[model samples]
Target: MAGTAAVVSFGTASAQTAPGPAGTAAGTTITNTAQASYTVNGVQQSATSNVATFVVDLKANLTVAPLGGNTPVSIGETDAVLKFTVTNNTNGTQDFILSPIQSLLGGVFAGDNFDVDNIRIIVDSDGDNLYTAADTATYINELPADQTRTVFIVANVPAEQAASLATVTLVAQIAAGGDVTRQGDALVSNGLAANRDGVVDVVFADNDSGFGDLAFNGYGRATLAYEITTRNVDLSIAKSSTVISDPVSGITLPKAIPGAIVRYCLIVRNATTLTPARNVNLTDLIPANTTYEANSITVGGIALGDECVLDGLPLSDAGGTVLPVSGITGSYDATARQVRVTIPTVTSLLPVAASFRVKIN
Candidate 1:
């Protein structure tokens, strides 16, 4: 009793524990605290409380990328597929909606000559990075954190397009709840008061990854784009004249003079870089003081209306068929002094020439 009355030890306030929160980044912050108390000499004494705090760090991060990069396609190509991938980093469940854009041509804003037709969005459920029989979904639904889903944009290319650049763009937006079919509401940072503002609940990004921003009161979105290149169809024309005869010389030769019969040969060429040209059309203006000879149209060395493909034709569109042209027609516009030729089809493998004799007046 005498020793207890002499002195009392003051307990160090429970060591003032300061613990950092754990199981963070899920969506909410968890706080914890502890206090120290003791009975000294039959009297109760209290000490300051020890507290620890940590954020839940609940956050949503999204990223998109093209699969296999850009690609080159031919005109009239059907079911062209543009592939992409979407990833969710929310540490929880999330969904994404899909949208398309066509503006990413060579120019920043100018649209290309053609648009992708019959476009469809496909989801890769098996993580195979391919649109397979096992994968069947219209949109992404309730994806897990750090997981990826493959997507494909399938469409048709229009026929008869010149060589040019094109693009297939895709946009993704977070949907309300876990509905990939529909967009989710926006998230408000105002906490409980912000609920039901048509806004969906979303984890905000605590750190900066540039994929998305902290959603204080909004939704998350991302974009993935790909380019489609088409080959160019080039057509060229060449013209020359050969002297068949002269009124003064009365003989066919390589000389130009008054009364000379000039056989004009026009060579039309299609390069091998692109698809064949259909319904090829040709026109020429008759020179003054020159009279045009009648029926001067030829294709691949074969004359118009020829019953069979002849060696005389420089290029044959018959695919080795006996006849290059089923039918050929031409007209001399005497009123306008012009010559025109029409062919059903023309190929790029060879040059076709047409010649008509014109007499100098």
Candidate 2:
């Protein structure tokens, strides 16, 4: 019976304990002490046979580095490269999924203005084609534990959107089944999880150094004055009064007639610091009752007109043409800082005043 009981116990225990059991129990004591001792030993042995299972510990290691022909980007341009390294730090291989996140701007003028297109990930291990869902077979390839993989990325910046500095980010995740560990025939998995996040920044320098440091002089204060020189001019008439009689009348009649001319002179000066004195024009109003035989007149040897007259004689430049005057109807002198105009004759005209313009410089 003892041998039979032992055989039955062994069979039952082997069947229950193949996969491992949580607890062990000793058989009840009977009249035979040897059998009880054997049962207690079996219980102790069973307890020792139970094994505690622990899940495998998995970790990820990642690094990011900027790469490209044009590392320091300019405004409104493209064609740059970014490199990243991913490592599996576990007892077994792991599968990973990498995606891009928004990077932060850095350096002076970093955020002045910028734009970025979608990030492109290239898996060199997978034949260097652009990463996409169809390429999952190549991307999911096992990265042996304690091993690293390099990934290449292409970055593009529009010429117009370039700035002094810019920032970018990338995200990496571990796949569910790929992140599992086996301890004592039990499996532990971390499921899907974010393994790493990275940031990168680019910088640029100012192009213009010194632009707004030139000196300039503005308009200065102006001084003005006027002087009247000669007040009149000599005049003569070809004929004098004469006596005449009507053909029918025998008696003769006497008549008195006269003719005369008047001239006036004017002087003006620029007294202010404003350079290049200008001419001041003056007009004399002839009274209505005044009479003149002829209206022709001259000033400083120059003929005068009813609407406008030169201040002095008609001056010419080296080219033989009339010298340009600053004032439309008046005169201007840079050195003399004065202007002079003559009114030769005035008769039966309304009161008028001279007007001119001046600039302070």
Candidate 3:
């Protein structure tokens, strides 16, 4: 324990004291000179022997790198991971308690999206991005000096969650068991400075002992985000038609032929599992050989007198000329010769149907 040991440099009584922060780390080596006596040539002769040497051990330094960016999450998603990193700046092994706090309520970024539920912290033991319960750890243990560890803050996103931004902040504190800046500083060295922010990093002797010891340096912080976005919409369109009659043969038969009335049905459904598809619009092209029957368009099984006629009700003060209805509305592009069905909204389970009859030439 560097934290609990006296860090003064080793030296002879009259030697100038070595300069350093303290704890375990010191100068490269300390050497001592001693005189040896030998009966040389019958006269007692004293000779200086080789120097005794001691080598300096490791030094402690801890620094946590700042987080780079925010995590993007989609609505109806689960188990999204927010990543961060922790580094051991010391020269020896260290242990750090890991803590992740969700942005508090009423806070700036925390104000939106409220909170990300079921938050869990995980350490990447194998250097892989995957997070497994077997790899979960509450604190960083035995992290070698100059080494770094990636951390994950995983959470479950609600399926119906709105499009919003969420976030979480992480903090790392040394939990003792590393190199110390000063002999006595290590006394309370575990979790160095106990979450010190304003306190100076260097500790000095009251009487100017010349050796300014750096306190156990174990404090770091970072913040990440969950950039929640709109869930993907699973939309599908189905087109089908039925023949009613033909004018050439005057055979009111249900077979397709020239001059036959073909009723085309366009079904637009939001096949999503948990979200609503918005502003859904369907488009179809009318062939030059066929002509669109007037006042033949209907939406949701109701006859539509005009484009804006939603279930026989005028969609707006402008009337049904091009109004929205029953979460559905439509328009016919006379110039482009295309029929466009505009759906105001569509749910996961409720599908909307629009139909119109086209007469073949």
Q: TM per model?
A: 0.45, 0.29, 0.44
Cand. 1 Cα-lDDT: 0.54
lDDT of 2 by residue, 27-130 (tens): 21112122222346456422233333332233222222222221343333333445445443333444555554333212212232343554465555554433
| C-alpha lDDT of all candidate models, in order | 0.54, 0.29, 0.56
Candidate 1 C-alpha lDDT tens digits along 211-259: 2223222223223332344355577777766677777667635367877
Best of the candidates, TM-score: 1
Weakest 10 consecutive residues, lDDT, candidate 1? 1-10
The per-candidate count of clashes, in order, stands at: 20, 11, 6
Error of 3 at 105 (Å): 7.5
Leading candidate by lDDT: 3
Over 1-361, each residue of candidate 3 has an lDDT whose tens digit, in order, gives 2222111211100111212333443234557899988896799889997977765443444444333456666564567787777766544466777776654522444334557778887777887756776785656777765577888888876655554666566656654454444112231232333433323233212111111223343444555566655567778777777676676655455577877988777666677665566667777888778998765666675322222222332222111433332545566766787777766667777677777778988
Q: Identify the superior model by lDDT, candidate 1 or candidate 3.
A: 3
Runs of candidate 1 exceeding 4 Å displacement: 1-29, 37-39, 42-57, 103-106, 109-113, 178-361
